[model samples]
Every structure is written in C-alpha cells, then in structure tokens.
Target chain A: MYGWIWRHLPGNVYVRILISTVLVVGVVFLLFQYVFPWAEPMLPFNDVTVDGAAEPLGTPRAGGAA
Target chain B: MALRALVRTLSETCITIGLVIVLFVVYLLYWTGLRAAHASDDEIARLHKQWAQGPTGSAPAHEGTAGGTRDSGHDGGTTGGADELAGDGGAGDADSTAPGHRAGESFAVMYIPRFGGDWSKPVLENTATATLRRGLGHYTGTADPGDKGNFAVAGHRRTYGDPFKDFPRLRPGDPVVVNDGDTWYTYTITARPYRTLPGDTGVLKAVPEPVDEAATPFRRSGRYLTLTTCDPEWGSSHRLIAWGRLDATRPTAEGKPDALTREGR
Candidate 1:
C-alpha cells in the first residue's frame, strides 16, 4: 500500500520531502517556543529558577522550616 | 537548482542559530555562577572585617552591634532588661572588649582537628553563601564578646564549600576559639542538643531555658555561647543547638592559642 501511494504522489521526491520537513519544524518550534513557555507553570522546570538573582543555590536542606 | 540551494541555505542558517542560542545559555549560567561566588566572597570578607574590627554598627548595611549579642539565646528565654550585647567580662572599654567581634577578621582559625587543615578558616555570619561557606555567622544579637549574655553563631550543614561538615563531632570542652588577631575567646560546650524552630525569635531572646532546668545559667550569672546549625546532623529541620560558655579569653603575643592561656593569661 505504501508503494502504490508513493508512486501516485503528485509532486517529486524533493518537494514532498521539503514540505514534510517544514511541517515538522513548524510544529516543533511552536511546541517548544510558544506552547511550552506559556504552559510553563505546569512543567517541572517551574520550580527550578535559573535566574541569577534568586536565593543562593542552596541544598533543599537550606529550606528551613521557616 | 534554486530549490536545492534554498534547502542547503536554510539548514545552514538553522544550525548557526541553534549554536548561538546554546552559547548564549551557557554564558548566562556561567555569569550567574560567578556572580554568586563573588558575592559570597565579599560577604565572607565583610564578616571577617566584622570579626577583626568587631561589630561597630557604625554604618548602615552592617548588621549586629559592638560589644553586644546578635539576638537571643535559644528557643525560649525571656527578654527583660536584656542588654544582650553588653561585654560583662568587666572590661568597659568598647575598643578592647570582644563583644560583637568584628565580622570578617580572622580572629581564630576554627580547627576541627577531625577535618584537618583543609577545613579551617575564620567563621562568618549572615546569609551570604561565601561567608557561610567559611563557617561563621553573626550570633543574631547578643552583647559584645565580654558581655553577660549568650553570643550565637549559625552556619550551614551542607554545600558551597561546606565548613561545618564536622562540627557535629565537637564534644563538650572540645575548643571553639574566636581569635581577634590579638586575643582568643575560648568557649567550652555545656549543653546537650536542643531543637529550635526557624523564624523562632525566642531562641535569640538572650536567655535560653535549660533543657534540663537544673543546667540553667545560674540565673544569668554566666555569659553563654550557642552554636546553631540545621538539625539532624545531616539535614535541616529544627536547629541543632550547642551551648557553651566563656572558657577564657587569652592574650597572645605570638601565635599561641588562647585555649592554652586559661588562667595563665
């Protein structure tokens, strides 16, 4: 079934490949850059702040009962 | 021909963009780490200066007072007429008294004989990572070194050049020396461990209740020294309290340790 579909394709190999590559890149870029950052609060990285000015990088033990 | 060229160009452009992004992130992380380390070092330096010159409170931004205690004693002590920073060793001169030792002065190189030379340096106070890394903290608020209240100091139990890694091994009378370049204040352990909550002001209240009431400080007759760290000897939950009192402060012309000057100086 794949062989028949391949033979019946409208465009040549390179054009099909280009289209597929662009689609995949667009989806991945959208997910990583826009979607993930917006839904960041739901992610595990939310708790890990990479910002410099945050409290000293201390062991969780540094988190006192206070 | 044009389509092939475009694909190759696009791939090259994407690769360059990805590399630049990666480099930028790396640079950011490196910059942050260096800033933290430098700040920590400055804090350690300031703490040493405080220990050397003593807590003058002469300028803003400097915490603690001269010849006074940091804050309180332990978990639950009353604060009536508490001149916690008073240097009660009977020497009235502010400059000569040890109360509120200077922040960063290398008064004494704390030696945990168990950890050997690599683990020794002047202790510091404050929340600075570099200062705490060196193992000294401001004893909240207490009278100056000579005063009649407990002088408290705190440090971390782990990470960023952990200095208190072996502090748990300090037995009673196992010397804790605070050297002010000219003299050494030796403290001897007197109490067993007690639990203190974080943000609990009572612990800094000048008088700490005797865990066993019999061991109380003879109704405020003797000055106290308290060592605070995160409890459990491994992790921080409550504070692990190590109580001590003025063993002796010895004047040294040479590098003679003050622990040897008890009664002779």
Candidate 2:
C-alpha cells in the first residue's frame, strides 16, 4: 500500500520524502482528532456509569449492596 | 511477478494496519490525556471567572425550585438537618449558589485530599461522554452539593486525564471537599471503595444501600456524596464506588476547609 503511494508521488526522492512526512502527519492528525474520537464510545474504557442499558456481567448481584 | 506483488501489498497493508492500531492506542492513552488536561484546566478557569463575577442569585428562582423537586421525594425528617446547614448564608446557600444546571456546564470544584494536595477538578453538571472529558461529571437528578440526597459524581479511572486514577486509594474517613463558588462542603468517606458492575445504578440512589444491609453506610439520606470510576485502571468491566457523608460546611470566604488545609489531615 505504501509502495503504491510512493510510486505515484510526482517528485524527486528528497521531495517525495518531504511529502511522505507531511502525509503521515496529516493522516495521524485526522485519526487522532476525528476517527479515534468517533470510535471511542464503542470501546469499554470510558463506560464509568452503571446504566441499565449496558451489557450485564451475568452476576445478577454484582453490586453487592442492591 | 504477480504473486510477488500480491504478497508485497498484503505485507504492506498488514504493516500499515499494525501502525495505525498502535497509533490509536497512543491516542487513547496519552494524547487523550493531554487534550483532557487542557480542557479541564480551561473549565476550571472558566468556573473561577464565573464565580468571581458574583453570586448565583440571578439564577431563575423557578429553576432552583425545579432542581430541588427530586429531593422532595425523600423523607423530610433528614432533609431539614442538611437544609439548615445549607441554609446558612455563607455555607448553606445551596439553592442560589449553583451557576447553571445546563448539561455539560461545570458548576463546582472538587478536591480529594487523598488524591493529592494539588488535585482538584471542575465538577460538571452531567455525565455525558463528552462532558466527562472536560472534568468530573455530576450525575444529573442527584442532589446538589450540601443537599439532602446523594450528590453523585463520576470520573474516568484511566484516560481523559484520569481524574479518578487513584480511586481505589480512597478509604473511610478520607475527605472529598467541594466548592460551589460559594460554600465549601466537606464530606468524609464512609466506606472503602466498593467494587460493583456498571449496571448497578442503585449505588447512586438517595439511600445507596438497603436498610437491612449491615454494610450500608447510610440508613436514610441526610447529605451524601458518591464518587464512581471505572475499575481495574485500564478497563471498565466493573466500577469502584466510594460513599461519603457531609461532615462540614463553610463559606468560601472562610478560606479553604480544614480537610483541604495542610494541617487538617
């Protein structure tokens, strides 16, 4: 995939490297600022609340105090 | 030649995928923390500016009444005690002190002595995902600071600046102090961190536990506080809860509460 990108660049090796660096940075920026945040809610790490809609852990009385 | 090209493309695709996955993890672990730290700092600064502007007296009287409607369902007997403490002009002005109840609005600052002397986070009004990213989030429908019911707040245990990173470190008698730009309400942790599942919304109830449970810290709601966070540091399979009871209330003008002072602990 990267090879195709490299081959398609219309520049000398030095300029190609610069363009590649910029592209990489841009892609990372897009992933971090947009893609990852859009994907985070689907992950379990931020589920701090005990909402009824969340998946049950099968232990009906896990809370102990219920 | 075709086979060689196919294998090269497949390997490159795999390498790209791996790099992206690693980068995503980095974003989740460190980049998110960096962003959240800025967001939290801004929120705290914004809250301080709002407080400095003046008291929250101009807030609609009907909105204050509406906010208190939930607490009315609890028995009035215990409510009077908290009300009296909250009624005092300096510390007890719970009704008129909250800035706004709008979702995502930050209304207070919380300090957990156990978390660290420098540890303080703005307490926002709701627990929405985006809201929690800014700072600790107050669960909507719960009691306000120094009020008669459970004043529950939730924070991330790992990412989003890890507001509750040391959640499990909290123990009974630890102090969780809150300032609503008016009063400093100090609550003493009444129990060790209780491990529970995410679906146990009961833990946020006015009375957290059942009446018969010997472990129940609160028999009836007077002035309670609950702090919750994702369990296991890096995962959210479980939740860790710490319950607290309002121990003291003082006007912000009195300076920092004893719980927050260097000599208090």
DockQ of 2: 0.34
Residues B142-250, candidate 1: write the lDDT tens digits.
4334345555566555433444546567666665665544335566776554555444433433565634455453355455666666655444445566667766544
Tell me the TM-score of each prediction against the true structure: 0.47, 0.83
What lDDT score is found at residue B169 in candidate 2?
Answer: 87
- CA displacement after TM-score superposition, residue B106 of candidate 2 (Å): 0.3
Q: Model 2 in CAPRI terms: which quality?
A: acceptable
Model 1: CAPRI class: incorrect
* Model 1 segments more than 4 A misplaced: A1-65, B1-118, B125-134, B210-219, B258-265
Provide the global lDDT of candidate 2 against the true structure.
Answer: 0.73
Tens-digit lDDT string for candidate 2 (B170-239): 8899999998876677889988888877767877777786222555777654678988888778777888
Candidate with top lDDT is 2
Each model's C-alpha lDDT? 0.45, 0.73
Highest-DockQ candidate: 2
